[model samples]
Target: MKKLIMSKTLIFLFVFSFINVFIKFFGGSNTLIGVTVVTAMLMFLERDLTIEPIKNTFKLLGINVFLGVLSFLAVQNIGLGVVANFTALFVVGYLFTYDLKRPMYIAFGLQYLFMVGSPVSANEFPVRLLSLAFGALCIMIPQFLVNKNKLEKSSKKIFISTSEDILTKIRNIKENKNIEEINLKIENNINSLKKMLYDNRKDEFYLNDSAIDILNMGLSLERISLILDNYYDKKMNNNASDLNNKNQEICLDIMESEIKKLKLYIEKEELIEYDINLDEIEDINLCEFYIVLNNIHDYFDEYKKRKNTKSEKLYTGNLQIPSNFKISNIHMRGLSKESIRFSYAIKVALAGAISGFIMDYFNLSEGRWIMFTIFSVIQPYSENCIIKSKKRIQGTLVGGTMIFILFSIIKDPSARGIIIVLAGYLGSYTTDYRDSMIFNTMSAIGSAAMIGSVSILFINRILFVLLGIAIGLVVNKFILPYDIKKGYKYLVDMYERVNLEMIEEINLCIKSKHNNYKMKNLLLVPGLIEDRMSLMGINDKEQKHFIKEQKHLTSSIYNLYVNIATNKIKDNDFNEMLKESNCISECEEVKDVIIDSIKNTEDIGTKVACKNLLQILNSLNNKEQKITV
Candidate 1:
């Protein structure tokens, strides 16, 4: 109770109420009412205070204003208004995030619908715009003033925890214990670390480049995991000569010692010195490990250099708007159909039109809530809709019950307003929490009560919300229902295609005697695959297996690219060697198999391609060893 009272949410709520009071007492125009709604809507989007709240608040405010004006201009009829809403929703969904839960316009989109439904004359648009701008500044200025010291402290905590987890996973691999489980655990930790980096990037006020360094370090750790997997494979499958065995032991010890030193430096806040020698390794796999180990050392060296010049104050008050507004950039890749985005845009438009029609037919008051609930419950995938709808129904029932009890007991309007504001403040903090539906539903009920314009009939509100959910289900499932299985298959094919492209690029790099191509697509494949898998809700075991296999193939090819880049293959007949070894034919074979599988929707091609690709990798590794020797 005390923590809730002292939370930053309470600060926001106080500012909100204070602004409303100011506008009301000063006889602010009806436009100010628009400002109040816009400001309140923006407050719902304020999920993480760890980020640059002021910067994001301003950027989102700009987007809302843009959409609001567009929605206003395009409200000629229901058809055009739906078109405007669809365009706005699609653009926001694409540019803002691929994550459904964090749709950049989740609140703003609903507001646009409300504006469309309740038309304002063109003469008043600018005043409402200015009013919105003013309200956004008022809300964001206080957030900027409250500099939470915990931001930097939390960053350090994440750094230490991530570093510790990495070292422990390395230790586990060395012991050959719970190899699969440990690798999955490490991957999860790395993902958490990456998400932290993304979250911190939003905090432009306290932007730190060290997080970038940490992310690079994490990638190096993943590369190390690949090296370890290859090492284990070689050790298990092939018999090493006595000298090679002794050399492998020496290399492993040196690598482990360096990792321990890196952990100590990160945990103790000390400068690091590089102490690994990579010049004398006989094993090709160990040489690859040595290269990544040196990369990790370089990260620490760079960190030490920047540590001396680390800024004193984390908050700088410098903020830039996000610039992800390019429509051409949002290709329909991995979405199975080119028309998927179009389908979703139309679904939202139809839902809005249908919702408006229903409201008009029934003479419903507070119909905006019905439209809001429709979009809130409906998702691109039917499975997501079903899950969300169930939660929404459960939440609405409980919230409506609570509201009924509260209003039944409390008769004073002022007292009910204060309680509603307090409850809304508590709900604001839990918008993204696990039980967010319940909290948000309760908050909605409280808000409706405070407005007190319509009758406070809890049953009517619940029924209206249920009507919206039913409409959403019918729209999402029966009308152009999304094929999740097909989407998953498309992702599978895309991952393979990208991998093949990287290989072909590497082949060209060797043939052209240049390494200008950086294989950026190779780096993105794992993340893209992971994102799709998460949306589809694949198990950890499946995700790990796929990533492990894909990582192995990419790591092998990347090492070969690095070797060629470093002029290690210049004196050798690289093209002639590749021809004689049948590497190209093997690659072509894998490509053909993948194409067949994608065409037939069969896993046989994937299985064959993975096997052939691994063989090609092992063949390349042997060739590298012979050339280097």
Candidate 2:
């Protein structure tokens, strides 16, 4: 249950807060307050966006200038301002197609632009742009210091830790020491493995072979834990607290011993040599037992193949990827209604346009805050928007109340300044939406009070933010409305497509007798979709089935890759069988060829790979799980 916010928030507390304090000491105003807040957010976004320094440089300069100009133009004409908001929001939504992190930094830059963009003379335009350039510079510090490599390394480290944690759990099961609680912890660690993997994926659009190894390794760990769960449940009576069967106790003991050895092997530590044969275990269900045994040998198999393995990259297009692009991440797509980015852009742009028009026509106090609120709460899905809006409102309420109480007690400007600084730091350090808003409310009210009359700023902010939330929710529901239901089918289709592509690649690798598993970057597709579906606050049978199928499908594909590609089991015989079966339109013919070869072959690698291919084909549409000896 590690909160992702901890490390990131600590970095924000030290790096960006220092710069904010420096600005405050040198005549900071309301505009600077907005700038500092946006800069803090930008620092977080920057960490997710770029992997290299030069790419960041171009992005920082180009994005700041674009947002700065839009903001300045937004000030001159009301109609143009409405257009500016729409265009900016559209770009944010559309950029989601390119990089997952694009919308974040762009949206933060918009806020900075708006803060220094308005109610000023023409002569102030250059100065405003200059300040934004400085904001980008502030963000660059954290981005360059803590980039994707740090997290990628962190992900690898998690692999070792997950194994150790599972090792502890297995030992607990052996001792029967609060086995239920240990099971819970094991489940939590499995999820942690998933989160850590995707956290790295979300940061980069590129992935190397090592990243792919992490995903496959995680899949193996997940299967190991699940198989253990099933075996222990059947073996140990949880409800009756019944004694372990004396008949099976020895087999379980052997499992525990072997798992410990497996952990040591993954850590590259010396293993205790065993005189006994693993396959000789007298177990009722040798299926799970053999799967675990095979999994233990998997790391070594992959390692042997990886030595001469030419790492492949993602992207099948003619356009050369700018970076080395070594990592696997989400793939790009075309414009369509089903596209998350396309529909999201249209929805956000419409909301931004409406918010901007209201701000201009009514000239409501801090009306721009309404647009900001709309931007913050509105998501690709309206259901998510409602949930986010609720949290945002709760945050604003508590934050406003805190500010009123604290400011009421301390009337001295110097004393309040210290309090305000503390509040801002907490806000910057917060990763939760509700908590951040609570502290952000105090800091916002206190900072505004310093520049203007403190009379009604707190109440005005509370009301305005609420109004914005209400408006955003309504607009999201009525305009280009999308929910998890709409996206679920699309994601399922995408999942199927990616799986099919993997099967195709496996076929090609067998034929060529060379491996080219280049779909690593796009491996994030299933995980990302599953995550979003979970966030929808859904628990229906249909959604649950979808989630289950996704898990099954992805794990099957990874298993297939491990069996066929990672082991490097293919030889001239595999190519010849593949060529002989090429005339058949169906993979069933290929599966038949493989199954026949498996019965005739004594090579362990070839037999295991052929069996796995048969299983994979069986899962797809065939039921040929066995072959006569």
Candidate 3:
């Protein structure tokens, strides 16, 4: 939290506030209101969805500007305006979902919806469009610059924090806390680390060897944590008396020392070396503990050596972080009915269109609120959509009522600005939908109040919000409804198909020179599965185990394929050379092949690839069962 306050989010937020204040000081508070509200909405979109905010900001603004013009023209004719709203919402929704893997506007697509909401008035159109551009620039430019150096910052934070968490949980077990609960929290953190690393797989091309070392470091920590969790689960529950009086103390001491060393590394980038002689511990109960500490020591020592030996990709000519947005592949993966991505787009388009038609025909004041609600409330799945809709109503009722009272008491504009800022921030910091919406409603309504009657705006905003959520819910349930279980199965089928194709491609690439195409589903499918599993919230032990294992297995196969292809070991005679290694035998597992190859291979690159491949495949073979909740 301390680190958060001093960094990018804070810095850009300051810039955003300053720019909005400047706009407000010059009688653009209406524009200021628009700017602030839209920026808040865009915050969810860009921050959650895209890594390249600076680039994405430009791309999105260009689309918004074009559509803003079209919306202005369409609004001149009421009939055309309804159609335009539907078409704009539908097209943007569908095109963005074209890439199934999110930041698929998972949280908000309000920025685009806001663009097409303007009426036929020429005056309002430019203000809305210009405010959006100004609002986005104020935030995204600083965000891009501040985050430019933070490419590996999140991964490193996760790595260091989760490592500390594991050590802390180990200590907590000694405190006689609920061992199961401690272990579950540790597992969730571990999953967070994996999700962050995997979600950014494509961006990894920009990561240097050192940055990747941080990611690998996190994975290693997860492995060590898993070992501890499994060991403790059995030992703490079954051999409680035996452990408490025996190796637990010794192991705890070792873990405490490692925790200190881990902190030093996070602070100074210093590596650790375990001073303990594991041979002397001699305690049967703590054997795994000693082994893990030894592995951590080895990892740091190797990390130190590689830090010196490997060229930093950041400085290397081979590093090719694209300066422009890469065109995402636009091919449809399946029928609209089967895909969650398409279902979401279709539901959003229909809801927005139907609601827009109703609002326009009636010439409803703040009619866009209904469209916005529909867009925001209608999630990919129905259950979540239902909850979000309820929260949207609950938040608006509670927050709108409170803000109305406060704004009535204080006629001071500056006071309202203060309320706006505080409410906006409170919303951002909140995690729960209802809780954040309380603050978000306060902020949003407060912003709208700057230009209109608080009473009229409040009442209409409340009415439109309620109306919108209703339309959204109806559309989501009836219009191409999505099933979480079915979605998981679709992704499972995709994973099977994509992995086979990937392996085949690896085989083909090695056999031929045609290695140019690799399926994007290789990464996307597993990620989608992860997202679905998270949404489904599966609690059954066996089901979780199978899903986790499936993910690991696919990841392992992908890793092996990547290693072989990356090393360009197409012509390398690891198979034949393996027969000469005295330890080599016929393949019982994939690791056997890598083991044999690494044994005989003298080429540094092939040996490295083989060794890394060995580590990856070991994940599948590891006796320690990884824990998740």
Cα-based lDDT for every prediction: 0.57, 0.60, 0.59
Q: List the residue pairs that clash in candidate 1.
A: 52-203
lDDT of 1 by residue, 246-302 (tens): 665665676677667767776776766765444343444555565666666666567
Give each model a TM-score: 0.71, 0.75, 0.67
Question: Which stretches of model 2 miss by more than 4 angstroms?
Answer: 1-17, 21-50, 96-121, 148-152, 168-255, 266-334, 362-365, 391-411, 422-438, 451-455, 513-517, 522-524, 539-549, 566-579, 582-601, 622-629
lDDT of 3 by residue, 1-629 (tens): 87865664684486466656756743452343355444545453333224546556786567656666656665666778667766666666665663234534532256555545634356555676675556545545555454443435565566567767777777766665555565456556555544544434344334334544554455456455654544456545664676554566666666667766775776577665556553454443244344434444554556557656864444345434332222342324433577666787778877877887787789876787888788878877777799889888988899999899999998899999998987876666677889878897788789889988889888998889988887887787788888666766665565556555554544554454323223322433454455556657666776567555555455445444544545534325663443343221122255555666555555544554454344443443445753221
**RMSD in angstroms, all models?**
9.0, 6.2, 7.7
- What's the lDDT of the predicted structure labeled candidate 2? 0.60
- Regions of model 3 farther than 4 Å from truth: 1-54, 95-108, 115-130, 152-157, 166-207, 227-311, 314-327, 395-466, 488-532, 551-629
- Measured by lDDT, the strongest candidate is 2
Model 1, CA-based lDDT: 0.57
In model 1, where do residues sit more than 4 Å from their true spots? 1-62, 73-87, 90-102, 117-123, 131-163, 174-176, 179-182, 189-217, 230-252, 264-284, 298-340, 360-363, 428-435, 450-456, 511-518, 568-629
Scored against the true structure, residue 594 in model 1 reaches a CA lDDT of 33
Tens-digit lDDT track of model 2 for 1-629: 24656765676566555656545643343355345545554545534444455666666666666766776677677889888877766765675433222234334534543552244456766665666676656666666566645544555566567667767766766676555555445445555545444444422444444545556666677656644554565546655324435644565566667667766766663444545542344332333445545664655445436534744344354533323243332223435666767778877788887877888788775776777787778887767788778888898888888878887777899988988878866676577888988887787788778766554887788778888888888888777787777776666676677667666656655465423434454455555556555555675887765555445545555555555555445556864664566422265766666767666664555554555555556557634343321
Residue 17 of model 3, lDDT score: 68
